[model samples]
Target: MRVFLLTALTMIAFAANSVLNRMALAGGGIDAASFGSIRLIAGAVMLGVLCALLRGGLTLGGRGRVAGVLALLVYIYGFSAAYTVLDAGLGALILFGVVQITMFAGSLVAREAVPPRRWIGAALAFAGLVWLLWPGAGPRISVVHGLLMAAAGVGWGVYSLAGRRSTDALRGTAANFILAAPLGVLIGLALPTGAAGTVIGAQGVALAILSGAVTSGLGYALWYNVLPRLASSVAAVAQLTVPVIAMAGGMIFLGESLSLQFVAASVLVLGGVAISVLPLQGLISRSSGS
Candidate 1:
């Protein structure tokens, strides 16, 4: 039950990040570069403080430190820029679809044992996502923006894999955010003006701070804490819920429309994720053995 709650909160946090990002970018609250920069810096500050007070300080060096930081940077930038053109839900769909693929492929490359059921579940979820995002399914998708989201997905997948090796989730997450904050500044500066707005507003800054300090920073740390407890496939499939949640958020918060297709696709996604992660077999086996 505790693990379930933690995982659920993590998913909500992840979905909220999308809503918040879109709210800032789409609402003209801030530019993509500025939002990303503030998010990274806010995340760094929040996590840094937490680490100092709670974890006894942060560790800047570890086995997967470089990969984690690099992956995080890519994800932060790609995600921000993609939202410049992509709707919140659309961008999330693209991001998680690629994430599903990247993580599944990574599992195979690493020779991780993935059950057949997990594969079927992942496939089902991906199919639902495809149907939801199919041409004319919802909103029109931009090829360039879709590609950018895909890259973000890959970055996220790699970051997840890297974080799995962490000895301390808080320390590792704090270090990643801290190290990436300055680099994020450089990346923000390097972004093409056309890709994002140049204007900075108070509402935009507030949104960025909320996104960075709360959803992203705390949420990521919580996820890292939960990751080691879940199988790789289970973890990946579980994230299928983020897009659905984000879509709902878009409808309620962004005034996007809801459709029957969304209802159908959401069912498929939820069912798939449940099948992938539930421990029915374990419980049944234990009962039988007893």
Candidate 2:
């Protein structure tokens, strides 16, 4: 029950990121680079303080630490930059689609034995994504933005896989944010979105804090805590829900329109994810044995 609740909350937080990013970006309150920078810095501050309070200090060094930090930066800046031109929900779908592919590919590269059910689920989810994102099928997706989101997806996928090996979720998460914050700032200045003349409003700053501190910082901590308990394939499929949740949030909060095609595709994608993650094989085996 605790794990379920935590995972659910984390999923909501993940979805909220897309909506919040769209809110700030579409409203012209914050530039993508600045938003990503503030998000990392704010998350770093929040997580650093929490780690200090809870764990006494931060462990800034670990195996694969550099890769983790780089992955974090890629996700932050790529996600932010992609949103400048991509619709919130579409960007999310693209992001997660690539995340699924990346993680699955990583599993293969690492010679992890992937089960057949996982392949089916991943395929279904990918097919649903393709259906939704198909040219002239649903929303008009931007190819450049799609590729950018795909990069973010790869980053997130690697980050998630890395989390499974973490000994301390809070400490590790804090370290990633702390290390990435400075790099995010530097990358922001060079990125087109981060240059001078970008507007930043109080409302945007507040939103960024919420995104960084509550949703991202704490959210990632929760996820890292839960990751070790789940199979890699299960975790990958579980995140397929984010695009649907993000789209719903966009409609409710951002006043985006919903289409029937989206609903159908969502159902297909979710069904695939469910099939992949559920313990159907176990149930079938038990029933047969009984």
Candidate 3:
């Protein structure tokens, strides 16, 4: 029950990050580059404080440290920029779909023997994503934004893979945020004038801080704490809820409309994820044993 609550909370946090990003960007409260920069810095600060209080010191040196930072930067910037054109729910769907496919492909490349059920599930999910992104007569989704979200998803998948062996998730994550914050600032500064914006109001800054400190920083720490307690399949399946939650939040908060197509695609994608990651292994074992 405790693990379930923690996992649910983590999923909410992930979903909330999408809503908050959309609120900030779509509302014209902040520009993409500045929002990304603030988010990284705020995340670093929050995580650094958390690590110091819990572990006395932050660990900055680790394998894949550079790769993790780079991937994180890519995810952060791409995610922020994508929201400028993509709706929150749509963006979340794309992001998670790509992430699921990327991680599954990575496992195969590493010679992990994937179950046939998982393969079928992944294919279904991929088809759903393709259907959603297909050029159609429905409300148009920007190809540029879709591509950016895909990039963000790939970056996040790589970052997750890099951090798979972490001994201390808090400290390692803090170090990555700290290292990336400055680089993010540089990226923000380098953005074109139209992209970065000239003025940042209090509301925008507040949203960024909340997204960084609460959703990104503390939320991830909670997720790491819960990860060891969850089965790998359970972990993957649990994330399928994020897009649903984001969709609901988008409709309520962002006034985003849900098209029939979006709904259908979501059902396909999430249902596919459920099929892929649900524990068929137990059934397989029982049948074989019998």
Candidate 4:
């Protein structure tokens, strides 16, 4: 029950990131680079404090530590930058689609045995994503931002896999944020400002803080804690819920329009995820044995 609750909360937090990033960037409350930078720094600060409070000291070194930090930077910056043009719901779908593909590929490379039903579920979920993102006339997607979001998805996929091996999820997450935060700042410094009238105000800072501290910082740590117990495919498929959650949040908070297509796709995606992660195989085996 605890694991189930944790997993549910983690998905919600992940979905919330889309809405928050869209809110900050689309509204011109903050520039993409600065928002990414602030998000990383804020997460680092929050997690650093959390580590101290929980463990009495901070431990910053671990296997795959460097890769984790680099991947995290890729996810943070690419996500923020992509949202400059991508809609919140659409971006979440792209990001999680790439993430599912990347992790599926990684599982193959590692030679982890995957059940056939899981593959079928993944295919269904991917098909649903395609249906959602299919370019109609007057499509709002920007080629540049779409590619950027794809890159972010790959980064997040790698990060999620690396996190599965962490000995201490909270400490490892904090260390990665600490290392990545400065790199985010450097990348921000190098980029030329593109959007006019972008400024960070009190509301932006507050939203960023909530995103970084509660949703991202603690949220990522909690996800890491759950990752070790989940199959790689199950983890990937479960994230299909994120886009649906983001879609609803966008409609409610960002005043985005909802379509019948989105509703139908939501059913497919969530149903596929349920098929992948539930205990159908176990039930079948038990019944046959009896």
Q: Which candidate's lDDT is highest?
A: 3
Residue lDDT tens for model 2, 1-290? 88777788899999999999989888889898889999999999989998888789999998778888999999998998888877677778778766766777788889998889868877887787777667777556676776788789899999878876778878888999999999889988887854436677997888888899989988877787797887765675568678888988888988888777767776766776666666778879999999
Q: Score residue 211 of candidate 2 by CA lDDT.
A: 93
Give the higher-TM-score candidate: 3 or 4.
3
Tens-digit lDDT track of model 1 for 1-290? 88888998999999998899999988887898889999999999999998888888888999899999999999998999888777677777777766666777788889999888768867876776666556776445676776788789899989979987988888888999999999999989888857444868999999999999999888977887898898855775668679888988888999977666656776775666566556657868999999
Off by over 4 Å in 1: 1-9, 129-139, 195-197, 222-241, 268-270, 283-290
Clashing residue pairs, candidate 1?
A: none
- The CA lDDT of each predicted structure is 0.82, 0.82, 0.88, 0.81
Supply every candidate's count of residue pairs whose N, Cα or C atoms clash at under 3 angstroms. 0, 0, 0, 0
TM-score of 1: 0.84
What TM-score would you give candidate 4 relative to the actual structure?
A: 0.84
Instruction: Return the top candidate by TM-score.
Output: 3
lDDT of 3 by residue, 1-290 (tens): 98999999999999999999999988788888888999999999999999988899898899889989999999999999899889889999999988877888879988999999879989988898888777783347987778899999999988888887677888889999999999999988897647445548788899999999999999988998899899888897788889989999999998999988888888878887788878877868989999
Candidate 1 achieves a global lDDT of: 0.82
Question: Model 3 — which ten-residue stretch has the worst lDDT?
Answer: 192-201
By TM-score, rank the candidates, best first: 3, 2, 4, 1
lDDT tens readout by residue for model 4, 145-255: 877898998999899799778778888889999988888889977876684744677777777888898899888778877988888556755676788889888889899
Give all TM-scores, in the order shown: 0.84, 0.87, 0.93, 0.84
Worst 10 residues of 2 by lDDT: 191-200
